[model samples]
Target chain A: MSYNWNWDIFLSPTPSGESTYLGWLLDGLQWTLTLSLGAWIMALVLGIGLGVLRTVPNRLLAGSAAAYVEVFRNVPLLVQLFIWYFVLPELLPTTLGDALKQTDPLAQQFFAALLCLGCFTAARVCEQVRAGIASLPRGQRNAGLALGLTLPQTYRYVLLPMALRLILPPLTSEFLNVFKNSAVASTIGLIELSRQSQQLVDYTAQAYEAFIAVTVLYVLINVLVMFGMRLLERRTRVPGYIGSK
Target chain B: MEEFDWTSIPGALPILADGMLITLEITATAILIGILWGTVLALARLSGNRPLAWLAAAYVNLFRAVPLVMVILWFYLIVPTLLQRWFGVSQSSDIRMISALVAFALFESAYYAEIIRAGVQSVPKGQVDAAFALGMPYHLTMRLVVLPQAFRNMVPLLLTQAIILFQDTSLVYVIGLADFFGAAYKVGDRDGRLVELLLFAGAVYFILCFGASLLVWQLQKKYST
Candidate 1:
């Protein structure tokens, strides 16, 4: 009860002279969005590839895809981020390692976080895609083949579109997870939203305000994403499909 | 690349084992507590009590919206002091673990609530109507007829969440608790063989979670009609 509350800490000039605490928080939010967006793109691309590979008839291709999912999905994102940030550069060839080490610190952190999140999320997305594809009728693939389409063409023209539509809900959840998991990047010095809130508390001691503000921002993002994905689900829904409503 | 050393691991195992114990303890405790609270919230949501439904909804929304790390930090900072004053329990050695448990339990309840709600909904409405027609009271109908079936259906989903909870226990490193991930981090930092130590740690997590999830996948396949 005796604790003093400071709502104006955001307005106070920061010690770094760049901007106030509000700016720092916003900057952190920007990093979070950038990291999540970048990771999502990577997740979709790699995830779809791996997902497709997992479903392919070739034992080797499917095995490798399953291995990728097992490796990336099982590891903790924090551990993976550390490996990416610290161990990976060292594991590279000496010249490449030195080059990575010499890059600008912020860019280095950014890329490390981005790659870490992307690959980690890609595993979950791969599972979603695999399930989606698996849920389609066997007749569909047979139908595509019966129409004189090559296997690749059949997947591209028929199977993938239907599967992707069915999987949108799970895909949306994975997308939201990327935003939430981006918080782990702060451990490796990425300065995203969670890190910024921690820093704000350290500097201003307004733990309640800093965290409440950050929480609200996160809720806004989550709500927006939920609504947006719901709209997409409605737009892309196939009539008579399961879960269309 | 430098030559790899494997000897550091055996030396670190005892500490790492302790950390693993903590991680498992937290996961088990949180799952139990979270499921209990989640069942209550799910029932409230389904009970047609508007105010109770809204309150449960808000808790679920707020907890789900925020990151678990923030919740952990909030409880770490806020709860111990309150407990100390209110309960007169001294700030004991297990405070960190206690706070982590509370936060994980509370945060995970939101997720569990959703799963339980879905499970409850999956049971046919006609089942409830039959129980009512048989002169079963509402509470007895839920407790004796509805809940058992709902819980059976929910077991796989609950286990899946527990697997996720196991992995997330690593995040306790943020608060300086030496859970499995924290143990690896510290030992790695101390010996300067972070690559080897972390690789070993990642392998342990992978084996445990991947194995458990394989079981879940099997169960899901078995249960699916």
Candidate 2:
């Protein structure tokens, strides 16, 4: 039961000695970054569209958008990932399904993870965007109408810019959530950092060291993300308005 | 073409029901322990003692940064070895379950502490000052004045955290605990009813999560309004 507590095993040369563990970790970090960036872009685009739709003043469009947000937001990401990876291809047409199934499994899994993360995060983004839009003063829209600007123009030139500035902090947090949630992809065989750490632990029997490295890596990445967002926040701060505590 | 067998429901019902109980137990225990520990951590973080705050912060950061799957795996696979080596006691599956619960509770406490801290911070400074003016001791004032109001205001957020903890209980499956999802996978694997079994499991999850959402909605309406 007594482990020799070999810190040396973690520090030593890799078993194969051709590829270091740091190399594996860096590869995993690349996938993590790739997945998060892809997912964030999709989420932002779809979320903005859905957010605008939710407030379109048309009941059906608004209600449908609301439903989308509710369903995706309420479900757990892990379950959604499972359904996306395992069931969606089977439900497709034969030719397309076969093509999807025959595609590189790793790529397919990564894409599925991206899709699920994007869709799931989109729900939250929709809510944030809606709140941002709603928090706008009523007079802005009225002034836009008074100036003979169209509704879309009001949203584009006036409302969205100001609203986005107001909601930047929350949006940043949502982005962070998206990044963290990418770890869930590791469950489905994606070679992300968490999974890579697990593999290293399995091989080296150095769970403590492996996890410590993983934790430090995560904290570092998250801190860097937060710092960058803080700079963005300051850059976008409204001139006259003092930020509330 | 194999006809979709809808008739598995009657037989699967009892088995799935058992799994539901296990799921509920895990979720309930996690929430209970998580809330208790989380509250303590929150208080510690908010305490004036610098070292205690730092220690609490470190604990929170460590757990929150690591994925829950890793935490559960550590508890199930490594903790047993560590326990035997350190204490000379053999560990059982039951003990493993307890370890999982402890690990999850500790992890979740970090999040809950943040939530609770936010709730506490939202309270007006004048209220605490007013309590102090009345000559109430710090601990008594916190217990009687601050926490009750903070907790009351935090009902919606607390429910949200509970829902998350409930969902995360699925991570126990990595350690071979036969919770709802694990049961469904087992049933599917046994009969090659993968799609059907998963759909059934998804329905159960949706129901539980949706129910939690409805409860939260009601609570928000009742408490906030």
Give candidate 1 regions above 4 Å deviation.
A242-245, B221-225
Which prediction has the highest TM-score against the true structure? 1
The residue-by-residue lDDT of candidate 2 on B74-130, one tens digit each, is 676666666777888755557666777767777788888888888888888898999
In candidate 1, what are the lDDT values of residues A130-229, reduced to their tens digit?
Answer: 9989999999999999999998998899989999999999898898888889888888888999999999999888899998888888888899988999
lDDT of 1 at B24: 95
True-vs-predicted CA distance for residue B138, candidate 2, Å: 0.3
DockQ, per model, reads 0.76, 0.44
Instruction: Report the CA-based lDDT of candidate 1 relative to the real structure.
Output: 0.91
DockQ top scorer: 1
Candidate number with greatest lDDT:
1
**lDDT per model vs. reference:** 0.91, 0.81
Model 1: how far residue B46 lies from native, Å? 1.5
Native contact recovery (fnat) for each candidate is 0.67, 0.19
